[model samples]
Target: MDQRVSSLAPPTIYVVDDDDGVRRALAFALDLDGFEVETFESGEALLLRDGLDAAGCLVLDERLPGISGLDTLRQLRARQVALPAIFVTSHPKPLMRDAAARAGAPIVEKPLEAETLIAAIHDLLRGPTR
Candidate 1:
């Protein structure tokens, strides 16, 4: 069998942040950590893309250009795409926390500790059984 044909792809981390600097930094960090990373400038872009059903998780920014992170997650859930998500925000409010919790996504406040974000991603990928 051809190695390319049989080889499995690495798990992907879908990152959606409007800020270029933040998005790039996250992609770099997650890439270095041995996971494939895909980035989008806004939640809308992520929703427009296909292949979200792939094995992986999402790292979304709460304040997006068009749709908020919570709304994005709600849309994904409506479509039956229950990929584990970690929401990052610089200014988190109680309402946002409540919404995130309702969507089954954990919200992590910024400036993000690399270890914490990485650990969250790992834990999410591991599934709830862990």
Candidate 2:
């Protein structure tokens, strides 16, 4: 494959959330917004996936069934997956905020507005928030 060809491909957004409805909604919205979206139901499922480096970003839920989103981020970092990430959670606690900051991932709270989440993704893609 040509380098130029691959470079022209749409960016892939990896979404890790337990809720089926959220995943479907996100995938649909993001696709409509002209991005390639992949959905994972758990941190464990995401961890099992290959080519994490190929993704443009990750939108993760703070509380997951298998491993919390924070832990998933930790594990990904441990494996040297440096993709930009953000948390989409409802009312994240202070501790989670601190951890997310430490990890350099911004948190966009739930009841999510497409514009807000999209803006966050675009901003993070442009440059690190920190």
Candidate 3:
């Protein structure tokens, strides 16, 4: 993942996806949109990162190597991280869909439309009440 260091810090969007292509593509796109993105290949990696409580948001794949996205989010929430999250999935199962709803994260289906993800990020950045 690419992070453009600037004198002015942009909003931080932590992205966790196993697919290197997807992770790098997202970092490139979000970077253009003026976000400081840090990427991870697994929930374990993300979990190990510092400063998630101060993060702006998260974009997580529904499936991962070690922990599922839901479990990752749950652990974060359990720690009271409270960062808003979006799930990107190629094929979403009904059970997972239901769980995502319970988690209060929107699912953006892949072959991802950048606009959709960007809009969601903006909305999340607005506030929890949005």
Candidate 4:
């Protein structure tokens, strides 16, 4: 019933962050690099999305306002959706990094580098090990 669901595509990337500027920047950069990108204002917005295509990676902010990014990642995994996610965070704590690694996701720092971000996206696009 959702319009977004009707046009989902594999190899797509979703950027979820509370900051409008960050979301826009990431989306623009990825779009220029030939990736279909969708921006969400919050983790909840992303959670409500439908028709997830395989090979898609979620780029979520670790400090989302309402729903913490770690919790969101846990919920997704619990639902059997093994999406490869790259967390963007301003504060990089050891516990956060460990948790992200445990979730099989990578953490990219706040001021993201273009090449590194691209590489992370590429790795996610590669999908999980068989």
Best by lDDT: 2
lDDT of 3 by residue, 1-130 (tens): 3445545467899999999998998999999999989999999899999777364789999889989888999999998898889998988999989999998898999989888899989987787672
The lDDT, on a scale of 0 to 1, for candidate 1 is 0.88
* Candidate 3 vs 4: which has more lDDT: 3
Query: In model 1, which regions exceed 4 Å deviation?
Result: 1-7
Per-model TM-score versus the true fold: 0.89, 0.91, 0.87, 0.86
User: What residue pairs are clashing in model 3?
Assistant: none
How do the residues 35-118 of candidate 2 rate in per-residue lDDT, one tens digit apiece? 989999999999999996454899999989979999999999999999999999999889999999999999999899888998
The TM-score measured for candidate 1 stands at 0.89
- lDDT per residue for candidate 4 within 4-115, as digits (tens), equals 9668653788888899988888888898888889999988888898876667888888998999888888877777877789898977899998999988888889687767
Model 1: worst 10 consecutive residues (lDDT sum): 1-10
Provide the overall lDDT of each model, using Cα atoms, as 2-decimal numbers: 0.88, 0.91, 0.88, 0.84
- Residue pairs clashing in model 4 are none
Stretches of candidate 3 exceeding 4 Å from the true structure: 1-8, 53-55, 128-130
Residue-level lDDT of model 1, residues 50-113, one tens digit each, is 8784598999999999998888888988889979999999878888888888877888889988
In model 2, pairs of residues that clash are none
Top TM-score prediction, candidate number:
2
lDDT leaderboard ranking: 2, 1, 3, 4
